[model samples]
Target: MKIIQKHELNSLKRSVDQGTEEQREAVKKIIHDVKQRGDAAVQSYTKQFDRVDLEELRVSEDEMDAAYESIDGEFIEILQEAEQNIRRFHERQRTNSWFEPAADGSILGQKITAIDAAGIYVPGGTAAYPSSVFMNVIPAQVAGVERIVMTTPPGKDGNVPEGVLVAAKLLGVHEVYKVGGAQAIAALAYGTESLQPVDKITGPGNVFVALAKREVFGDVDIDMIAGPSEIAVLADDSAKANEVAADLLSQAEHDARSSSVLVTTSRELAEKVEEQIETQLKDLPRYEIARASIDDYGAIIICEEMDEAIAVINEIAAEHLEIMTKDPFGDMAKVKHAGAIFLGPYSSEPVGDYFAGPNHVLPTSGTARFSSPLSVDDFTKKSSIISYSEQALKSNGGKISQFARLEGLEAHARAIETRKERWK
Candidate 1:
């Protein structure tokens, strides 16, 4: 990782809004073809991208059963434990419809309803993420989403990974489809003959998938357009250089564009961490990818004080922030913008990524400045409820009409006036 001064941080901010013209055009064509041709377009794109030709798009029960049999008992047990943690955590986030009644016979409240159906996009190809299945599906389930569908690209053999299938089946998501890429997003946004449309979509994917989500955002609700995974560790003299280096590399291995930054008050520790990263990268299996990411996007910022470090962290608004300082909890109070905060050395980022209860699908590329992690709230909608008695309308209608008239909205003024006249 390159060592840079604090002023250079602005250059490290990943451009979340920019995409190449070729990528946008390709995604647009795929989405258009899918919208026009339906399942045929989806199938063609699936073959083109995944190199798999499938007679069936949906995963059958028999295949699910085979997947269960293929996996061993220990892994299944681990998945069960993760699911319970995820479910328990999200259940706390569930909200109920409420109404507040007033003495003037007015009722005001929010009616919360889960979306009818939700689709989650899971990536396939190099890696298989059963954890993603748990993280993405469980929150929708907690929110009481009626139908949860999942779409993942199949392998060259035209078979979904056994682990992926097993995780989906565990969550009771049987409506698994063997489609991926921009076309799969289009299929989810607009219904096809075989796959039904969903009300909302969630989960992360490649640039094409992210761009596709951006394109179909209005047609269907989607989670934030996630960028490359990133991690920022704020450390002091007390932190172990090796552990900090290891944690930074954990995120760096995610992709060539992933950002791993270390901001610390200790210049001595910073130099040690720089050395440790080089030592550790030699043994890492994904060394090439991690090296490219660290060489290009990674940084070690030496701050003068903890407050300065905290300010730098907030400005970056990293997706994951870890504090290995003596008082991590105390320092965390000063942090305003990270998507997920990992306190102390033991609370490494991976804990939240897999086993811990919090959803792993976090806002990336400085989106943490405004957006948040995917939760039950993403799968639900809120409707405002308003009720007014005759006496209440008579008391307030004249003022409402006057305000409406001030805005030159005659129809709005008349509507209130008509109600007031009836009450009188």
Candidate 2:
């Protein structure tokens, strides 16, 4: 890992991959075919990309049961426990409809309602994220989304990963499809013969999936166009170097473009962490991916003070920020931007990625500077409520008309005054 001064913090804001023009065209072609031909197009792409022939697009009860059987009982228990924790956390994020009555007997407030349907895409192949299933599904479920569906690619054996199916089954997300890539996104956005169109889509995928989501966004809401995983550790002399290196590698192993950075006040800690990372890379199964990520994107920023370290963290605004200082919470207070903050060594980034209650479907690629983690709010829509009594309208109708006229909206002015004229 390269060590740099605090002045180099701006260099960490990476330019997100928007995919090649060829890939974009390819995705557009896939979406168009899926929209036009529906099930046939989805099947064709499965054969082309996934190299699997699917008799049915949907997962069956028998397959789900078989998936359940494939996984051990202990892991099943673990899934259930994780679900409860996630549910408990997201339940707190649930917002209710409210109305406030005024002196004039007018009711003004907001109404919250979950979208009618939600579709979540889970990546298959080398990365089968059962944890992602838990994180994405549980929040929508907690928000009371009625129809929750999932999609994943099938293997050469014509089966989605057993863990994915098991996770979806635990959440009662039975409307899972065996389609992946841009075709699956098309199937979700535009109803196929088998799958009904959803109001919104969430979860992560490859460049094709991201582009497909971008194409279909106006038609249906999407979670986010997330970039590669990132982690920035704000540590001090009190922080242990080996533990910090492991945490940094956790994000590095996710992708070749993933970034793992350490912003510390201690140069000694930075030096030790660099050594530890090189040693740890030897043991990682995804050594090539991690090594490239660390070499190319990762860094160690040496700040002179705790305040300076905190400022660097805010400027970077990494997806996952770990405060590994003597006073982690105190440091967190000064920190302004981060998708998710993990305090101390125990609260590792993966802890949030997996069993931790907070959603792991967080803002990536410095989006935390302006955005937030995926929450129940993403699944739910809010509506403003205005119930004006006769007296209230009579008092405000003229002002409303004046306001409308100010904007040169005559139809809007008449819409309010006509009601007032009838009151007269």
Q: What is candidate 2's lDDT per residue for 60-164, written digit by digit as tens?
A: 999999999989999999999998888899999988899899999999999998999999999986877899899999999988899999999898999989999
* TM-score against truth, every candidate: 0.98, 0.98
lDDT of each: 0.93, 0.92
Error of 2 at 207 (Å): 0.6
Model 1 TM-score is 0.98
Model 1: residue 200 alpha-carbon error in angstroms: 0.9
RMSD of 2: 1.1
Q: Look at candidate 2 and give me any clashing residue pairs.
A: none
RMSD of 1: 1.0
Q: Please give the distance, in angstroms, between residue 56's alpha carbon in candidate 2 and its true position after superposition.
A: 1.2
